[model samples]
Target: MASDLNIARHGPQDGPPILLIHGAWHGAWCWDGLAPLLAAAGFRVLAPDLRGHGESPGRKHLRWTGIRQHVRDISALITGLDQPPIVIAHSMGGFIAQHLMARGVPMRGVAMLAALPHTGALPIALKTLWHHPRTFARILTRLSLYPMVADPADAARLFLDPATPAPEANRFHAKLQDESFRAFLDMVALALPGKPARPYPALVLAGADDALFPPKAEQRLARRLATTAQVLPGAPHDLMLSPHTETTARHILDWAATLPPGAKPPATAQTAPQT
Candidate 1:
């Protein structure tokens, strides 16, 4: 059965559609800063809370599911669109995007921000822990066995810029949810498939100071996808909610403008919910 995902939409009804996928521990709410900017640029943006995150209502079963389930949910949403939508994914969401493209989902283009490379998140996590074992040890102790939510301070340290306001960081941390352990394992176990026969345009963006997927890692991912990696100076892993949100949004707008047109679904009468 297809899970009913909670979607947040923005922009004109007839405008080109773009789908924003959030990363681990985040829901559709993470796109709050970027969605309006894209909409104002004359594009319809759709950000959906993946199953078990935000208002999607599958939290109880999340521990047993993997990335494939998320791929299935997103595929269904895209299949329902008027035309293939451009995809912008972040963190683990980037991993999801890669799989979608590999499966031949018709996307006009894809933009990955601080995304987990095809190399997967496990290696990155292990590397980061190796460099800062004590810090991660403390963070790990706070996580529950099943659905694990990192402590707010740990999340802030790993994802926010040092200059970010305390309140803003707190707000972002408060929205963090538990991620699926099975999904994490799946990401580590899954291997990247050969490059797509019909390659689509791709953009890779990294936070210069991202503790998770650093610039070098993102660059490697770009190389694999045949695209260059762009870096947001001093930003952290969660670029969408960071101080550089506008700058990141602008870059996405510019890249999205260059893609060739594809399927565009007509505007619906349903109004976007308040953010």
Candidate 2:
């Protein structure tokens, strides 16, 4: 992230603060629906556009950035705050959040949404080719498998139920933007920082239909995090954009309800909840 990384905020200034970090190829707009929902709960929300995306400053010059770099930016933002806020990271952001806590940042709580937990590296072919000028030029000319960045129809069909209209997908797709090769390199490398995993209350959430990290994968990851995991049936990877997000948020908020800004995590989440 650049020195001018942006973490836009909303809601009451003194209310409990929650930071929502987006995943790859996504920006703060990813929380368009969820932010307002969090606000309605009388909570303050800060959704940052990481290094290369959204209105944030450093797009073209983020060559050196990887997962550790991004986590540093988030940690800096958290430290600058008047209070230690609960950090809720989604997908790749989940990895970043865990790394931040490991580095000894004062954290209220950490929640992972469909996060990647395995430390195994990305495919040799992908790691080698992600940033090749010729490779990216060729790949950019085509579609990506992730619906959040590419196909709106696919995104809608996957995220929404059969009753949802196409316009909803179009609206969501309008927020889509390009991601950096460096970001891919980071996740692929699993270069995120590591610690002995001081057990903070963690929540693992997923969508049953998430092609990226399906239910089984989420289960495996929860085991790694030593936390209980849940997947909303028929939901896709973009659970926040899904109609089920409010419910998912409440599931988390329910756990959040028991703890204050500086208090320890809930007993239910202190250890691992039943599967």
Candidate 3:
């Protein structure tokens, strides 16, 4: 059965819980150092590897599954939590967070870090990378890529900070693999809601140099929500592993501090869904 695939974790036992979902080509391991930092700020943290990522089982061969399934998997886990925890999503995980709360919800808030709002339009670079023959062959071969692109150096530059201690990015890259195509399909299919969509008290962050979620998507989402969005200038896609990782984490902690309680229902923001 599909479920939230968990990875490493560290934080307070009884403090407010923050559910962290990672992006494509990454797992909860990406949150390794950040989890403890957040925990020090007094929060319980759950960092789960999305299915078919990290050490999770490969869903590549499955008959049929998509982003909706991933969101449902995440929602089911949150429902079982002692409280409706705040969601800390990165990249693709941010998309999941929004989908989770498209309708009113019992969520605290969403902190979307370097995330994609809707899968409708990712950058041309990402589309090229995903569709490349070498990359496509890797996906076709094992429904994974870690083994195929075992370049720790490139992984560090593209996905983590070149300044990050060698081990962090190396270890993460060694664990990389093919993600389920269903997930990408679902991301592209995320139709805006018909009823007024939920106004997630969300934080849409971006790395100035983030080639994936460039300035365009970030500001657009912020403008749509009419909330201030923060951009980490000079940072790359691996903003977490870069020098600003700690700073970014601190910023999120500070923002989450001002959030309303988890029981309050989500507010409506987006316009009516198409017929």
TM-scores of all models?
A: 0.88, 0.80, 0.80
By summed lDDT, the worst window of 10 consecutive residues in model 1 runs over 266-275
In order, the Cα lDDT scores of the candidates are 0.81, 0.68, 0.67
**Could you give candidate 3's per-residue lDDT for residues 84-127 as a string of tens digits?**
78888887787777667674434687887877765353353356
Q: Compared with the true structure, what per-residue lDDT tens digits does model 1 show for residues 186-224?
A: 776754434554588999999999978889999999998
Hey, what RMSD does candidate 2 come out at? 6.7
lDDT of 2: 0.68
Q: TM-score of predicted model 2? A: 0.80
The candidate maximizing lDDT is 1
Deviation of model 3 at 56, angstroms: 3.8
C-alpha root-mean-square deviation, each candidate: 5.7, 6.7, 4.8
Q: State residue 81's C-alpha deviation in candidate 3, in Å.
A: 1.7
Quote the positional error of residue 183 for candidate 2 in Å.
1.7
> Candidate 3 overall Cα lDDT vs. reference?
0.67
Q: If candidate 3 were superposed on the true structure by all CA atoms, what would the RMSD be?
A: 4.8
